[model samples]
Every structure is written in structure tokens, then in C-alpha cells.
Target: MSRQMEKTPAFLTVVLYVLGFSLLMEWIKPLSQLTETGNFNVFIVFIGMAFFLYAVKAPRWIGIILKGVFILFSIHSLYFGESFFQLTWVIKLCEHVWQNTGLLFSDKLDSLSNEFRSLLFFVLLWLITYLLRYWMLVKRNMLLFFIMTVIYVCILDTFTRYDGSKAIVHSMAIGLILLGILFFQKIKEEGPFLSFPAHWVKWLIPFSIFVSAVLVFGYEMPKSKAILPDPGPFINSILASDRLNGPRGLEGLDMGLRENDTRLGGPFIGDNQVVFEAKVDSDQYWKVETKDTYTGKGWTSEDSKGNSFYTTGEMIWKLEEQGKDTSYGGQKSAFLIYQHPMPYLAYPYGIQSISSGLPNNFVLNDQTEKITPYESDTTHPTIVQYGINYVVPEYQKKELESTTAEGSKNEEDPKYLELPKSLPARVKKLAAQITKGDKNWYDKAVDIESYLQSGQFTYDKKNVAIPGKNQDYVDQFLFITKRGYCDNFSTSMVVLLRAAGVPARWVKGYAPGNYTNSTSDGTRTYQITNNDAHSWPEVWFPKDGWIPFEPTKGFFGQTIVHENVQGSLAEKEQKPLAPIQPKKPLKPQKDLLDNGSNAKIKAPSQSNMQKISSFVKNHKTSMIISVIFFAIVCLFLFLYRKKWMPFILIWLYRKKSGTETFAKAYLLLLKQLDQYGIKRKENQTLREYAVYVDSYFETGTMMMLTKQYEKYLYKGAEDLGDWKEYSELWENLIRKTAG
Candidate 1:
């Protein structure tokens, strides 16, 4: 008898049903897009019916038949039915899976149709439901069921991005179901039959309270740092070799582009896979590497050399020489890499030192401030984690302008100023025209930057035009195609500055992503993703080092703002350039003869909606908190209306009625009647109201109370029935109406 009871515990069956239902609800989201007219309610109903049938002790054969039927129904509804039962539907699905199986390992998994994806999800759901039911009914392992259920809930919470309050409610429901299962297990362990376990109630109440309190107050728990240990050398070797082929098999890793690639033409679409997390005090461009050599086609660093450094548990690569003096404040930043391993490390402009448990074979290029590992060191690499001490330089425009432009010239090689001989003369002419009147190199660079960022140019990621063979890239972009992405804009600025005799290099890295959270140790964490891949021009100042400039319209640049330079320096710079402006805007060159195909170009501006979206993104955390608080308040009012409404009505009535005790009592009675769905309308007289109540209760209590109140209110009669009697009638009426 005991063995039989284990096979079919009622409590276990109920828990299984509830768990399956919850999982089904979760799958509704992924499946909704696949169904016709976006109506997935039929599938939900079918799933609920299956659970209900199983809970009622359906025969094994019947359950098996029903499961097969449901699978067929799902397949038909998602694919074949849409095709009117064509024989080719199954073949099409098979072909799709065969062709796109490779995409599963890349970020292109979303390329599959929603219907096919939903069919796959349906199979997964069916299997999970079967396993869960078998575990409870056949294996009779309650502990295993509990553990698996908890794991499933955790995965759902992590991946689904459900809001806080909804997650809490779901968690609380699961907890209650688990508690019920535990109680049933306890009863089965004892005897055949037993009395209610009244003694356990005392402990259960406090446990429930403790759990509730934790759920409410601990919603924003500190997120655990994503620190998975390296999967050893063999696996890292496979990953390293695989990444060279493409980002096909490495979806989440930073596998899209290499740091020093020689070509940069493609669609600017990004998967936005998060690559790493940084803990810092303020926001700054996290620079990974810089390119000094521009080969007319693309940027490269083929001839660059670096100082090799070996790690002895903690490696430190100083940004400057030991005796060098600087006027910049320093801060510490730590980076935690998540996706694929890369040779370069992201740090701020002026890094002082790096400390990490890194491999002993890495090189630091002081010129570019880039760190890269040896070819052999990255075999089977895991996530790279490190910290850096970096300086945030403060600049004074007067000092930078006064400094000589040739202060620290690398006379041996001036690769930054190198340009292809085939570069169009119009490029240099335009640069000269823009900065003709500038007195200093700083002013010239700024003027060029302002020209690019002005409304005359636009940023386009999708429709970027490529230059024809033997055609200069910057010339085509500047003189012909005025619309392009970050590379086009940044490269243009670099070439223009170099033409103007200012040292500028192309720098590429990620833009700072959403500010996620902060740690108790005062370290703020940010999430950086693949979509944040960006490029900007960095100009060298005499004593200020490399200063980044933003020439792209939609993107914000972190250039140091000079407060004092605007007053005197601006007047001096503007006076000379004022006359250079054309009275009538020159018509843009329509036929550049680069590609021999004319394409209409329009400069895009940041729309008002985009500006508002940017503002919301910057303040997303505060907005989410405010919305959650408002939802909680609304839920509280809705759930406990009975407990609070009476007090609210009384307070409101008292404010209106100063000292009319009888009138106040009548008003409170009307409010109670409204609560019971017996409201008196505006046109109903006191006698009519009493008659309506008498029809339901078959009592004159309402009539008696109404008559006395009307007599006292309308006739100014002080000698009405005792106030105590009227109060008693009001209480009796309320009690009767409630029943």
C-alpha cells in the first residue's frame, strides 16, 4: 500500500500541474508571434487541458495518444495548415533547419522564422512536461522535482527579463506550491491516516512571513559578478582557431572584428552582444587600440612595435616613464570580459598600470597605449579580467595653444601624416578652405571637427558607399557621399587634420553602454556590447597627449570643454573665417565619377524623438524604479479596498459635513450601501431609496431611518429620535446588506 501511495501522491500531482501551467505561460511569449493573427490562446487552452486530464488520473494509453495528437496539432497549426496541407510544408521546414543549423552557433539565430522557432519551442515544452510528470508520478522523487523546479525558475528569471513585481508574484506562488508538496510528503512518511498537523502551523506562518519580507524588500539584490573560470587550454585552442573563420560559432563573445584588421567595409549591423563589464567612477571612452597607418583603403598598424611585459601573478604596465611628470588626476578601473577572448584590453586614455592574473606573454604599445597577447598565449583562452589605473587629464586651452606643435616629434618616422599620393586634390583644398583663417593647430582641428559635425553632414550605417578601385576613400566620402557611419566620419576627420599638419590617428573601441548597477564598494558597473563598436579621431596636443574629438552627428563625444577659450580665442578665430563663408551655399558636387553611379545624398539630423529616447536611456534606472513604485501602490489599493475604503469615505464626508451628526450618519449609510452594490442614484428620493432596500430585505429598517433623517434634515426639527437609535439602525442595515 505504501509503495502504491508513492506512485500517485495527490500533492505531487497538483504541484506538477501548477508547474507545467506556469512553464506553458512562459512559452506563450515566444510562441505568440508564430500563430495566426497573433492569437495563441488556443494553444494555451490545449496545454491546460492536457495538464487537467493528467491530473484527473487519465489512462496511460489515453495520455500518450493525447500527447501525440497535441504535437501534430501544433505542427499543423504552425506550418502545414497555413499551406493548406501541402505536402511540401514538411520538406520546407527540414530544408530550413538544414541550411541554418550553422547559424545556431552565431548571433544570427534570430534569422529563423517565428513559426519554425515556435515549433521547436513546443517540442521542448512537451519534453519538459513529460519529464516533470514522470519524476513526480513514477520516480516519486520530491526532492529532485523541487531542485529542478527551482533551477527552471532561476533560468526563466535570468533570461526572460521579466519585471520585478511580476517575478515576485510568480516566485511566491511557486513557494506556496512547494510548501504544499512538502506537507503531503510528511503525511506519507508517517502512516495511512492522521489528524491535521496543527502544531506545524505556528512554524509555517513565520516561514511564510520571512519569505514574503525577503521577496518585497530584497527585489534589487546585488547581482553576482559574471566570473566563470577558464575552460582550460584545449577548449580555448578550439575557440581561438574557430574565431578566425568568422563569428559564426562564437555568438556571445567579442568575435565580430579583430583589433587591427586592414579592411572596414560591410553593413554596420550589430548583434549588440555584451562583451564585458567595467567598474569605474565616471564615464569615459574605453579605448582598446589605435591605428596610425591609413592605406587609403582602410586603417592598419602593421609596422607598430611594443615593449614586451611578463606577468608575475600581477602585471603592471605603466602609462608613462618613472620620472615623467603629468598634470592629470588618476582613477582605478576594472574590466571583466564576458564573451570571446580578445588580445586587446580596454582602458582609458592615460593608463598608469595594469594588474591581473594574466598570462606572461603580452606587449604594451606605449605609442597607442594598446595591450595584446602573443599568438601562442591566447590558445583556449577564457574570459580576460584585469584592472587599470588611468588618468583623466584636465586641459587649459591657453596652455595647449601656447605650446609648440613640434614639441615631441618622432623624427625617425612620422606615419600619422602619411597619405596616399592618389588622394584627390579637392580633399586638401577643402581642408585648407575650412581652416584657412585659424591661428593655431588646435583651432584648425576644432574648426574641421565642427564642420563635420555640423548639419551639412549625416551619419548612415546601412547605406554607406564604398569607393571604386584606385579612388581615395576619404575624398569620395567628403566630396561625394556625405552620408556614412562612424568609420567614414572619423576617417575623414583624421585625413583632414593630417592634411592641415595636425597629428591625428584613428581610434576604435566601444561606446559606454547602459549604466547597470553599482557595488557597495563604490564601484559603478557598465555593460558594453558589440553594437557599441565605434571609431573616432584622436588629435595629439603638444602637452595634453591625445585628445578625442566627435565629428559624428548623432553620437556624443567626450572632448574636454574649454570654458575660457571661447571668449578671446573664439573672437580671434572667427574674425578671420567670417569672410571665408560663401554668401550662397555651394551646390554639392553631384557627379564625383568615383563609382560612376549617382546616388542622391541627404544629411540626417537627430530627430526630436531620438533626442527624447536618448534622454530616457540615460535615466532608465530611475524611470524603472519610479514605475515599479507606482505599480506597487496601485496593487495595494486594489487588493485591500475593503479594509481602507470605509475610512477614506468617512474622512471625506467629515470634511464636507462640519457638525451635522445626523446628516453624517446618513452619508456613511449611503456609502456602505454603495459598497454592497446598492447605490442610490441622483434622481432617487429618500422614500424611493428606502422602498428599493425594503424590496430586497423585506424589512422597514431603511424606511424608518430615512424618514427620521429627512425630517431632521429638511424640517430643521431638533426633536428627532435619539441619535443612538439611528446609529443602531445604520449598523443593522450594513450588517444585513453585507450578508
Candidate 2:
């Protein structure tokens, strides 16, 4: 029957369901991008454990309420958690000591706290389950059991605020001591350990095994070890040009210019300017763009698809005669110093010969650039290209003014023209207004740039979703509400320049200003965050090349209060946009963070020093437990006492021998009555004890029973009856006590 109970489908069903649920979440990760929290995942495990434990013992209400409380906590935590500290209690229990340790838990503390909070909350609930099961459900002596639970306070205090091992040991010692005391109270003249299988006692073994099995399966206990450190930023994966496919598959577009247009920066935020350090043989402009006009967001030289992620590497070669053997591997190549990153895919600048680590499938682009398939996230080794360097040539502001003379007409650039269905009429109207009556496309371009920098607008950072059905977002930015950030400002700039007969294009790149600190490796690194995202307009500078225009208002946000400067165009040009007023609140603030016992951070700090000091001041519970434990063990030896005593003669010499003997006689009387089924549990004099002894015996025979107890226990007769005599006396006493 026990074996059948052990193999019962009820317990196994719970385990299978929990394992199945966890596996389902694990399997769905790749497709759904769903990430599970430690608390959420562990709650499932805890539920199964609680259910199994409850089922084995058949304590329905305790288990159900425990599960219900966990459910309440889980619901409160799941959608409401904003800070990292939120969790259920079971996690708190697992990490109580770990968190107090402080050194290893610093970085991931918030996540740890959250999971721990869940674990501890549930663990407490489970503890309650045990308490309710044992107390109310099992119908034990709840008051005595509660008195026993006082020892667990010592155990709990040590685990959370003191040494974990010490807590377990102290609790163990107290429990063993209590067991010895209880066993003493239970022993009989018939010999104590001979009880037959009652229904209640038979249930204990399987229930104990069930709890041990729950602990052993480990079916994901909220352990402390799963806490992990943050890995670096996410990187995309795409292969190289030497790997048979040109990055973005640009092999078909062999205009030679198509090779240099693939992305080469490290990590990108959508489309932004990613600048790489460039070195070359002589000073030259590293031209990412060799065209006069752009028709779309991307470069329009050739059309080929490319993976957004690819590995990166660089090579240097001497720009000597084309037929010469490169110095790399007996080929006459430039002695380059590459220090960038590996499998060098593409460099922003031109190179000469192969110097360092270069993956295969790379071909020289006009002996100037490295041609490889585009990869978004390749660990492109940092390498030095010693062939050529690029620097913009100095220009006079007045020299380019002649391009926009009065009555001039523009020859439409084919690549610059686009009439996408995506563009709206409001876009054209805004473009027409910005470029009104300018002599040529150049003046119109300059005029629009001036308008964008003006204070006639506001910048709205809160993303305006679906700017009405008929209008594209860019069109709405220019016409509907001239208020927006870079996406709005740049898109307007592009349309106006194109509409006014100027060859224009859009390019995503970095702006000049950034707060950066140098790394230990002497590399300049920027702590670029999500807030640093930006976009702007890039215009062709005719003979000099493309020049960048930051059309977005520079001082869109600032603390100093100021007003927009209005006057003649040139005067306003000299004036910057108004600063934001300090009084005008920019963003909403929330005061949701909690502190103290109400804190969502789960286990608040209960350091050992504090506990030790508090205990030192008065460890009442620990001291009481210590006293109880020691007293019981002492009783074990002190029953005889001389064996455990060091100076027994001294103790015996000072103490009143008769007085001690008399007190012991009373204790023996209480024990005899307890064994004979009549004793004052709390308080009774010898006379009251003799009267109570009459209850379990016949009134006529009660005198004999009392006489026997007094003779053996108080008069020092040493004649307590054996079982045969005691049985006869007990039968007569039962008759008398019936009255």
C-alpha cells in the first residue's frame, strides 16, 4: 500500500506539469524573444513543490492557502514591478545570507533582490502551510508546538542575520534536546519503543520521504547561484566578402564605388554616423560618398541587399604599380600596422597592403579600399592603414556663393528626383514656403537651413503615433506641427532642398559634441545611451564634397529661460534659439520607490554585526533555547550527575543532602503518578496529589494507592510496584477514581 502511494500519479503529475511548463518557456525564447524573470520561472517550481508536499501529507487547506498567497504575490509582482527589487519571498530566503555578504552581490543586487523577494514570500507561505498543517490540521498540542517554534526563531535569526551554518546547528541542537525531553515523558515500565502502527504514526514515513524528495529533485529552487553579471551590448551576425557573397550582396553593382558604401562601424543605433579612426600614406579626403545627388535614405550608386551584421577587419597596401607583388606573404604590399579588430571586413578609409589578421575573401578596391560583404556585428580587429590619411581642405565662405546667382536655373539631377507615394502634399507646401524666390537651388538650401535653426518652432520628443492616416510622419512634422526632434527637422530639410532644384541626399552619421572619457587602453570611448540618438541632413558641397547641416534647433532643450530672437535673417543667424524655462516642467516624475520593511527590495539588510550586537545586548530567544538545550542535556547526565561532575564532593559537601533528597522524592512521586496515570501537570501539593490519585482508583482502594506512592516516593522506601502489582493497584484505583 505504501509503495502504491509512493508511485501515486498525483505527485508525479505535479512534477511533470511544472517541468513541462518550464521547458515550454525555454523552447519559445528563440522565436518570441520572450524573456522570463527568475521569480516568475521559480514560482512555477515553488507551486509544484508546495503541491507535492501538501498532497503527500493531505493537508488541503494549508497547501491551498499557501498556493493562494503565492498567487497573490505573483500577481502583484508581475505587471507592477518597475524597479529591480520586487520579488516573492522564497527568493529572499535563498539569498538572505548571500545579500548580507554584500561583496559579490553588488552589481546584480536589484535583480537578486527581486527574485529573492518572490522566493522568501512564497517560502514564508510554505512555512505557514507547514505550521497550519501541523497545528490546526493535524490537531497537535498547538500551544506546546508554538513554544517549540520559539527555538526556530534562533534558527531564522542566524540564517538571515548571522551565520547560516550556526543557525542550522543551533536549531538542530534545540530540536534534539526537545526530542529527548518528550521521549522521557513518553517512556513506560512496559518499555517505551514498542508502540504498534496507529493510523497517524504510519502516515509519517511517506510524508517525510515526499518532503526529502521535493528537496532533492531541485526542480529549480530559487538558489543564489543563478545571479549573473551583465554581458556587453547585443551584436548582430553576418559573414564576409571573401566568403563568396559581397556584404549586402553588392557583387552585381561593380561600379567600384559600390564596394566602399557598406557599413564598417562597431555598434550602431539604427542609422547614425559611426566614425572610425583613419590613417593613410598622404593627406586625402576619405570619401564615403563620391556622388553629387542622393534619391533615397541610402546611397544610390548600386542596388544590392546586405546583412545588417558582419565581421570587420582592415588591410594596408602600398599604392604602387598595380602589377607589383605585395609584401604580405611575398606579395609586394605595404607594411601596415593593423590594430582595430579581426576578420577585418571594411574600413572607412583606404588601405595599402595586408599587415595583420585579415580573413580570406577580401579583394582590393582600386588598390585603395578593402571590399568585403557587410556585417553588422563582427569583432572587426582594430588595424592601422598606413596607405593614406584624409582631412577636409580649408574653404572660404564667400567662394561658394556664386553658385546661387539670380535668375539661375538648375539642371535636375536624375538620382536626386523621387516622387514616392509615401510623400504627402503638405510636405511640398512646406518645402515651397521654405525655398520661396531663392535665385538658385543653393540659396534655397541655405534659406531652409536658416529656417530650421530659427525659434519659430518647438521640439516634440514624445513620439506622435501615426500622424493621421493620409500624411507621412515627415510631412506632418513640416506642415501640421513644425514641432519635432531630428527625425522631423531632417526630413523637412531633405524635401525642401530637393524641391527647390538642388541635388540632395540623406546620410546618417554622428554629431560633433559628445562627453567621452579615455579608457585604460588609451581608447576614447563614449557611454552612448538610448537618449543620445540623433539624425540630420547632409548636402553636397559641389567641388569640395558633401557638407553636413544640423537643421534641428541646437538649443531645443536647456534650463536657462530665454525667448526666440526675431529680426532680419542675418541678425537671427547670429542669435541662438531660446533656452527652455526652468519653471516649465519638461517631464513627469514618479515617487514609487519604497524603503524599510515595506520595501520591495525583498530582504533588507540585517547584518551580522547588528545581529551580534543586538544578541550581545540580550539574546533572550537564543539564550533561552541555549538554556533549555543545556538543561535537558544536563538532566541526561545530572539524573545521576556524579559521572558528569568534576568536583562532586564539593557540591555534595556544601549542599543539604537531605533537602536535595526530599526534592527528588517529590519528582519521583510526580513521575510515578504520571506513569500510573495521576499527576499535577502544572502545580499540586502532596496532599492534592493524593486526592487526585483517588479519581483513577475506587474510593475504598484509594487509601492503598496513596500509601504506596508516599512510601516509595516520599518516605524513601524504594518500593515502587512492578507491572504485576502496579496493574492490580491501577485496576482498583480506576474503580475508585471513577467517582
- Best candidate, lDDT-wise? 1
TM-score of each: 0.42, 0.32
Query: What are the per-residue Cα lDDT tens digits for candidate 2 across 601-675?
Result: 222234444344345436557877989999998789756442323233223433433323433433443554464
lDDT of 2 at 400: 37
Kindly list the per-residue Cα lDDT of model 1 for residues 1-739, writing each as its tens digit.
Answer: 3364455557656766786577436445432222212335656766776777778878878877887667656666655534635667667667767666666656577476655565666566567666756655554454554555445545544432222345445645565555555555555555445334564465567767876776666665776665753232223333443454354433333233345445554345343456677767666687877888888878877545646664422334443332122234444455454444455677776565555433335566765656655435334232245556555655567756653455545332477788878778898899999989777777888899899988878787555665544567788788787888788889999999888888889998877776989877666788887567788898776455667888877888865645464444324332211111112222222331132244333222344543444456577689889999999999999876656666555455444422256676777777777777887864578899999987878888889988888788877656675555556566566666445
Error of 1 at 3 (Å): 73
Query: What is the TM-score of candidate 1?
Result: 0.42
C-alpha lDDT score of every prediction, in listed order? 0.62, 0.40
Off by over 4 Å in 2: 1-229, 232-388, 405-412, 456-469, 481-484, 512-535, 541-543, 555-739
Q: Please give me the total number of clashing residue pairs in predicted model 2.
A: 79
